[model samples]
Target: MEFKYSDNDQLSVSSTREKIQEEVFNAKCRVLTEIRECGQLCDVQIRVGEESFPTHRVILSASSPYFRAMFTNSQFVDPNQQVIQLEQVSADTIRSIIRYAYTQQCDISTENVESLLVAADYFNIVGLLSECCQFLASQLSAENCIGIEKFASWYACSELEQIAHNFFMENFVEIYRTSEEFLHLEPENLCRVIASDDLNVKSEEIAFDAIIHWVDFDPIGRTCYMAKLLGCLRLGLFSTYFFVEKVKEHRYVKDNTACRPLIIETLKFLCDLDRYADARSLGNFDISSCMLTPRMPHGILFVFGGWNVNSPTNIIETYDIRSDSWMSCQTAESDYRAYHGTCVLDGLIYIIGGFDGMEYFNSVICFDPVKQIWLEVAPMYSKRCYVSAVILGGHIYAMGGSDGHTRQSTAERYDKNRNQWSFIQPMHQQRSDASATILDGNIYICGGFDGVTILNSAEFYTPEIDQWTLITPMLTPRSGIRVLTYKNTIYAIGGFNGVIRLNTIERYNEKSKAWEPGPEMSTARSNFAIEILDDTIYAMGGFNGHSTISSVEYFDIDNEQWYGAADLNVRRSALSACVLKGLPNAKSYVPSRSRVPIMDASDTVHLKDT
Candidate 1:
């Protein structure tokens, strides 16, 4: 079709703007090639340490503001000059800078990064300086973070300094133990590191040891700063035994006159746990602000296998209560198993019987968090699912669950000393999906289905007598309930009441032998995991009837309110969870000499058919 043109008509046009950009890029490439290969067009000579680099002054002037100022203003050198000498930077570094000016690219390695960064900053090359900062930031590690942070601060590289400082804080434990630079830290920097609540240490004992190590390395020189450094440690968090055996016994504490008052204050604080507020005022340091409280040790909550929306899963994840973050942990070496029972004893997590969709399992497994590995342990006597296991009197009591064919009232206890499971006196009632918690030296089992009906009956077992006695029943009959002991009171969290999912919560007072109403959960759920960290009860992912959920909420005992926390990465139900004391440190594990099948995040292990 032919178009007629009119004065009022407008038309849109498409143009190849990229072609013009390509032509400009080609011209720049040709100029760089000529300067590099022929050097005939070179108008400036940069002389450094017995070597010289010849390049066009126009390229250098455009790439760096320093060069531009020198050439345009003729401040120190004439634009017509053919050679300039730089004594501060080496020849190799000067050549690299010139190459970057001409080609807009340069290689930075560990050997040359420091020198190159210095030259870039000196020449006022913003792009090269940024590149060097980014490279150094990416290379920050426990071994090199101190040096990088110091260098970045000296050079006024604020972004690089902050990055290096954060890495140093997060990995301070390893750096303190292994890095030579830690001993050489300036007094101010050393105090700042020790004072930080974000330092991931297993305990204040580790931090104290680190301070002592630093002082002992150069005792005479560091003795002057002993009071200042020791003041930063959270001495109140240490036990009385540690203070007596480690702190008071140390030479530094005895020799330093300035440290006596601080030690006395710590002793007073330990004697009276309620003296933190008063001590803080007197000492000018807030003992209450310490990350590890006097009551609860630093720990991570490990959540094990559960059923996802579509199927069961053997995935594991950990929650760092201090950081309030969840990280994927090593998975288990078996088919997806939910309704499993778990308890921590002697630094090992023992996983007991549970269902795996098609069959009830009596199999038991042990997980070493440090080694990040799982090992098979002695299996239980009966095929059980939906069991409740608790560590009482140094033995694992695996109680009431279905055996695929029948609900079990049978029970067994595994003695770690004997490394075997032995039959224990059975409960009065058969129960599955029940909850068990230890209180006042007795194991209390409460609220579960008996394969016939949901029961409200609760019982406590005396290990010495090998007998179970009925206790006060709950207000409501529940299955899949979670029982936890806090402040000597038993809390029954959300669960199913056979008719509907429940948000109702109740507490049992062992001394009074009574059940009292408690604050309800935000959502009604069953088959979830509950853990008490620092007096707050966290209820994580579970089935709400129609679908599995990833939502998590914590019940603050002080405020008597429920608030949301971070959600799980996967929606699941019937998971097992427990809090293991100590900071999460993968390097703490001693490597096993014997070959054992280990399961990691990237790999899965299948159980051998027996």
Candidate 2:
């Protein structure tokens, strides 16, 4: 290759010299390293603690702004000065850093990371500073994340500070439970964590407990911070029993004048929740009342592709338990199907076997929540609607459904890695509208119509033997029922009992080997989407024996009853719901929180009027 002079006499490049430039850079680094090691022509000595390192002035100046300013400006350095002293950085840290000035390489690890970050930033070594920050960011954990966040912020490492802060909030529960640094956080940092809408707590009780513990750690120094932190909790969420016995009666809360108003406001909200629920139902409620607003949940519940208003709908939505709201997600353009079954496995949401309108489909669609795109996975062996779907042993099992023409007893499992569906041992009965769940290492499916009869029989399949065993039948001949497994207990609820739509609930007693009656749901409905959120069972939109309804409610085991939740935007029946946990961008699926906790609860109230 050659270069030539242009008409204007400027040299023009004829070929790329990228490879040659890289070799030249490597040669310069090697020669510099050798010279520094030999101490031949070293112009400066860096003294830290009891050690002095011989270094080249030109090399340090070229590598860092801190050195460049000292060597160039008299205000920073004397021309006759031959040595520099740094009391903040240890000699061991400078040795590696100085070596990096010559070789452009340094060893960074957890042991030396904090020291390296401090020294690298102090010396204004951009490359080394970046490496240290990256290493620290990767090493973020619940045990040390609070320390990392504090240090990163103190050092003005903006990017690392933000990452560490987000990690602390996302893993808040674990950090609070395990991190010793959590108790030592300054009031402002502690306030920020609790006030964040993204704080993940199954119940507000955890937040309440955290503040008490934190304040009690240094009672004299921290008691004054109780008011500031107390406002950060969603106090209206706690029952009156817990509030009076645990919070309102706590010495820190009861004795503090500033916390008294918040305490009173929360009591008002608790007494009037039913009234507020009515107002919220009519769209007249203020969701901005911080005490009433829910914190952002880490897991989002998805309800997609359902039978709505006498027809199939492709509308997709997610239930944010924290906010008690349903928000729509992007839908597949032409893939409207209903009576389908869905499950989340390996981060992809699978919609298997369902009917569109006139035709039954054996197609499978996978939704990539991050990409917001729908992709096709392997289809099932049979076209199915009213299908039973469960994820077991990392495989998605599609069991009996109608397939439009007839009830199918055929079963198949799809392997996502192979992109293939293999036939599995079929169920004993040709059942449609049967609900299935993975319980105790087996696929237990129960209650469905078998063409001529509404079957009360339930059965479980063991993959190891590829066989089905009949369990004792339910006391009632129920079809279209939903079965859920939680804490090793199987709960069966709401369905047609061959005579009428029933909301009666029963749980399978594993020891008794029989279905024992449990508390009934608030609404009697059939063919609804049921899922567990916040450790409770929420049953969404379905038929109420007359027409389709949009009512939603959750059953609380401790209270032994169902409570109303936000209703669906549109009426739905034969819908499928799946719980998608630990979504990286969970906020994208849930409602955006505009306000934090009870600061507004106290501000908007006039307690004296009472």
Candidate 3:
């Protein structure tokens, strides 16, 4: 026998289920209110200091494992006992904990969270303890992170400890300089923080200063561990000027007998860079742990130039992938320009021509993150808007774009030695709003609009031959698209195909000499910025035909799925982005573009200017 239902029966059944849920919710609210107001059915009295709380044993037992064990275990205290004395917890904390037991809600504030956490931990109230930890974790900053980390570590709250630890590492320099908590860190904790390679301080000079300050805080008590702490600082990262002028003559360094040999060895290593290898082998210290490296593997992604809702914006922001946070860069007044072409060379970012709402630009600017300065570079041969630029063979190649009047087939290259731009062999077809990337020593440029129509045509410039060679066209004609090289394959991401905004993506495999369909993006975006970090391609901020979007998403190569990342601070379109490696002040070097075996397409097509 089978049961069947009509449309009316199904509706009636759904209505009944919703009604039952509402009634159950109402009953729960009534029971919680009665427990708070009447307290007539409370079977147990919890005494803390001079105050006593009336609560039911069943609610307490259900809310906490410690209470459950105390009430249920025959070998422990009897469940029939009328009152239980809690000597460790305070009266206010006990009341808050009991109130949470009955209502599953309690106020957690800066003043009360610590005491509540202690009582919650003692009673094995995991939920309440978690709430307290989360509240404290959110309140973490440069000033309070050290204390929170220590507290979380002592209480065995691993999640909270990690959160506080990350904050401390990210802001080590400022915290060491300003936080009173930093001066109070225990020797072991201080050593651990100093030893971490993830510290984001500008130089080892700050680390050395931090060590000195710690010792000076309690000289007699910390003097014995001076050598141990000094061993953890990356002294090699400090400049010779700092070592000779500041550190060498410090009373702490000169007075400490055990630390003298370490200082001498560091100076010797600095004098003869080759001696670093030998010193590492001879010294018992872990050399790798004391070496300075990038805090983030692929560095940070800089998002530059885009149109806000009302108009073009010169705002520049950097996204820290590790922290999943955005920070504004201290850019110069001239740095406010959008719709520009961007490429990273010699650890420097080059911003090329674009429209800034009022005037089109042919000017170029170079940003040296290490120096934290932006310098106006040699202007391009012709003013271009919607251009694409890429670095190949130590020279930056500016590809086709509109000069605000005509779509140009002309290309140019910049010579760093002369600090000038010179015209190069022009493309066969005039195009604008295209994208370019370098692979196998050749520059690949793909899909954009000619003066008449959108294009699917693709081509490459061979430096050896010094000529542009046309390649297989894309599956769909698109302009304002973003192309990225990853894992030896080229991905063309989302774009507008003249009629509609597209989320479609495609990839080019050189071995097959063909374009293959790839995964589509979550949003149909155009003129967005795209960057590849650690094999994942992030698509951020673009126009979806009707409006600019601040949303960002990434495609995981291994999983073959798209997931959302943090949104930008402002909605934007026609933005540019690139990854910069290492902290500022580290030695500058061009980052190698290596790839794992993965293919992804998350392009941004150009939407026709409204």
Candidate 4:
């Protein structure tokens, strides 16, 4: 504690000398810091074998520890001394060496990578040597792999030499995107880099850039790659109008010439978008058109009949929303029949009680569009045509059909699960060709000609009570009219009142138990197809009394009016209509709007294009 000033000065001098010595040593091992342009103030000399190389000549960050260490003892043998000179190696060559040494503690830069790699082979830095081998393998080129192999073999870097040989052997044909100082590889390594899964490039620009490289640069090799990218984009999930408008507003001009592959991929993506958009709406198929059979409470639209002058219309004709076209489906029916009762439940279409133009059919035919098969179920209690079949509480309620002799007050129930029919309480009046629809879990049967005359009385049947209750009468007595359900309300469109073909339209509210007039059809037609698709009521091909017309019309329930649609592909009534299927997760069932599988003629008729 009582040291003299002279002793303190001597101690300070010793400490300064030690600091100077430490700085000198550190500078020797890190002389490249001088190149950083004043970032480091240390002065040092770097020894490379017998020569000193100034690091200030290289352009690199002075703060980089790697840059500092690279120049400290960088060396290669000289011909004069039988040692290699690593300074003679090109930047491209050093890249391979540096990359190899990075994974190991060994220096793999041109000056040290090869020598350390050789040392690793002899000194058994197994993991270190292994990293060098992988580096050499990764950097192998078609023109240089053999030379690298030869060098590795001479230096006893057997693993490195083998790696180089294997790399070139497997990836000799790889195409690489190259720059003056960089190389982005193709094929295997490129796939691995782009598909690394750990890459965090979330920007669309970067992702699209990567995608373009794969798609445009090597289309044949990147088919699956582009497909996966498009799938991920799922461009269709975006609203079409919004996407199109955005693209137009941005004036995004694609590189058509250079981006042919990208353009193709984009087009495919757009197509998928349109397709799925339509498919999404199919599940909500509410209304399309309606038609009437010849019997009461049972008279529903017979949708399987239509005639085309240009082609034999054996297929089903459907209403197309986009084009307003009547798409003819020649395969709607397995057998030629009209005046049939059609009902939908659990995605299956059940056709019951129709005339095949030859005989009154009592057999219940169930058509499955998914399976493309038709099954026959138990016959009704009495053979009925113009019979009403309504689905309530998981059972089909069959009411009133004639046996070509007399209309009966008959009612029966068909259990879907059991595939059996049981007798139910009959109606009060003997009625046939009656329009019936289910409302509030009750069957409402209206207006049909009894055996003697056209009856105006309507009745409601309760499945729970197994009884029919007489309800209010319609404004007009009509038979062979079409009935539809929309938003908890029922609508009757077009009918014959014994003396005239009427275009009158009526709406019924179950709550009020009354019928009211709505918009009438443009054409006064009878025996027409009226259906519901897309929640709108469509009036399809029907007879106008003078000739069979191809006129088609649709009703706007919200607007409470009818508008013109595409005419039927053919001009025949007594036809039926149903929806089509779509891909999984698809919305609408229309094939035109969706990317549906291309169906052949045979398969075309079997599928329901919802």
Which model scores highest in lDDT?
2
Question: Where does candidate 2 stray beyond 4 Å?
Answer: 1-188, 202-206, 234-250, 257-293, 330-334, 594-610
Instruction: Give candidate 3 misplaced runs (Cα > 4 Å).
Output: 1-298, 330-334, 585-610
lDDT for 339 (candidate 4): 57
Instruction: Give the TM-score (vs. native) of candidate 4.
Output: 0.48
lDDT, candidate 2, 1-610, per-residue tens: 1111123112123123655777898999999888888999998899988898888888999899999998999998896788898887887899989988888889998889889988988989999988888999999999988888888889899989988988887788778877789989989988988888778776678887778778878999999988889888877667666778888999998889988888888887776664443433425445576776778786789888777886898788888776567887643332688888998989988888888788888888888777677777667778998999999999999999997779989899988756789998889999999899878889999999989899888999999999999999887777778999977899888889778888898889878898889988879989999999767888998888999888998877766777787788778898888887767788788766653222222222111100
Top candidate (TM-score):
2
Candidate 3 worst ten-residue window by lDDT: 592-601
Residues 1-610, model 1: lDDT tens digits: 1112222112111124656777798798777867566877778788887888877778889899988887787778986788988888888888888888877789999999999898898988999999999999989888999999999998889999988987887677779888999989888988988887556564577778788878878988998888888888867566666677788778888867998888887777666544433332334433334422321224567788888876788778876553345666533333478988999999888889998788889988887777666767678999879999999878999999988889989899997755679999999999999999999899999999999899899999999999999999999999989998888899998888878888889999877899999998989999999988645788999988778998888887767778777788778999988877653563122112121111111221111111
- Error (Å) of candidate 4 at residue 461 is 0.9
TM-score for each candidate, following the candidate numbering? 0.51, 0.68, 0.50, 0.48
Global lDDT of each candidate? 0.79, 0.82, 0.79, 0.55
The clash number for model 4 is 61
Candidate 4: C-alpha lDDT:
0.55
Task: Kindly report which residue pairs in candidate 2 clash with one another.
Answer: none
**lDDT (Cα, tens digit) per residue for candidate 4, span 1-610:** 0111124456668889999998886675454333333445323333334553222312211323344344444452221232223454444433333333232234555455575566455434456566667677676775566567767888777777766655443332232222211133434544443433222232223433444545565555554444334333323223334334432232122322333454455455455534543433544431120100000101112245443332223455444343233444434445555555667767667777766556877877776655545767667767777776677888887788677888878888887755678889989888776767878888888777788887777888887777889987888887766676778888877767888877998888888989999898988766666666545677877666667678877776666667776566568754555443221211122334333222111211111111
Q: In model 3, how large is the Cα lDDT of residue 26?
A: 69
Task: Judge candidate 1 at residue 288 and give its lDDT.
Answer: 36
Model 3 lDDT, residue 261, Cα: 90
